[model samples]
Target: MTPLEILSTTATGLGAGLALIIAIGAQNAFVLRQGLRGEHVGLVVLVCMLSDIVLIAAGIFGIGEVVQAVPAVVVVIRLAGAAFLLSYAALATKRAFRPGALNASAQQGSLNRKVVLATVLTLTWLNPHVYLDTVLLLGTLANQHGDLRWWFGAGAAMGSVIWFSALGFGAKLLRPVFAKPGAWRVLDGLIAVVMVVLGVKMALGI
Candidate 1:
């Protein structure tokens, strides 16, 4: 492919990946919360971007077909994802209803990096939507570029890196606003709602 063609294919992949991932979801919510708290932001962003890279690559390389061929895998993921989300939703609800204010600094002090990493992994991998978006949709889309498919996949991976970096870093700018307990409550409430909705939808295959 010519230079122009490669650039165009990569750009197309970037746009498609961005379009699929820009939506609201459990992963986004978790990243935002961690960013706000300034707790393991780098690790969270790394895990998220890396996970996307792996999934998108798998899809582009044809593992997407293998995944699609096994409906049982998706079913298993759906059930597990639903269970995890529901459990997270309950925790968020409890936090939202707590009498005390949400203190980011105080909360950060209490957090275990290992726990955060584990949660990040769970949020990234357990969600069925990640496979659907990164592996299946982005993979299939990249393959449409023919020989340029690898470049397309590269672009999609770049897009994921860009987005998660922006979200995790840019969120610090909003730290002032999140300093208040009321703001934390509102944010947690929104997260709880999102988790519950997604969990139920996954459970019902909606």
Candidate 2:
């Protein structure tokens, strides 16, 4: 591909990837919460970025087609993801109702690093929509670029890195607001709602 063609394809991939990822969902909520809490923000962002890269690469390599051909696998993932989201939603609701002191500087009652890492991983990998959006949709779109598909994938990966980094790090600016316990309650409540809605949608395969 010529230089102009490469730039065009890459920019198209970047925009497409960002459009799908910028939607409000369980994963983004979790990342935002973690960023607000100032707890393992780097790890959370890294996991999300890496996960997106891997998924986008898989799509470029045609694994998306294999996944689509297996309806049973998708069903299993959907049910499991729904269950996990609902369970997390319950926890978020409990937190909303019984919020602890939320001092950003104090970092009081921070969750363990391992727990945070696992939760982020589950949120990223377990969601069926992630597969559909990153693998199937983006993959199909990238393939349409033919010889420039890898460049498209690279651009998508770059978008993931940019977005997650901004979200995870830029959240610090809102630390003063979230310092209030009431803010924590509201944030957790919203998270719970998002999680519940996503879980229900996944469960119903909607």
TM-score of each: 0.96, 0.95
Error of 1 at 64 (Å): 0.7
For candidate 1, what is the TM-score? 0.96
On residues 13-74, what C-alpha lDDT tens digit does candidate 2 reach at each position?
A: 89998999989988889888888878899999999999999999999889899888997888
Query: What are the RMSDs of all candidates, in order?
Result: 1.1, 1.6
lDDT of 1 by residue, 120-179 (tens): 999889888888778988989999889999999989999999999999998999998887
For TM-score, the strongest prediction is: 1
Cα deviation at 78, candidate 1, in Å, is 0.5
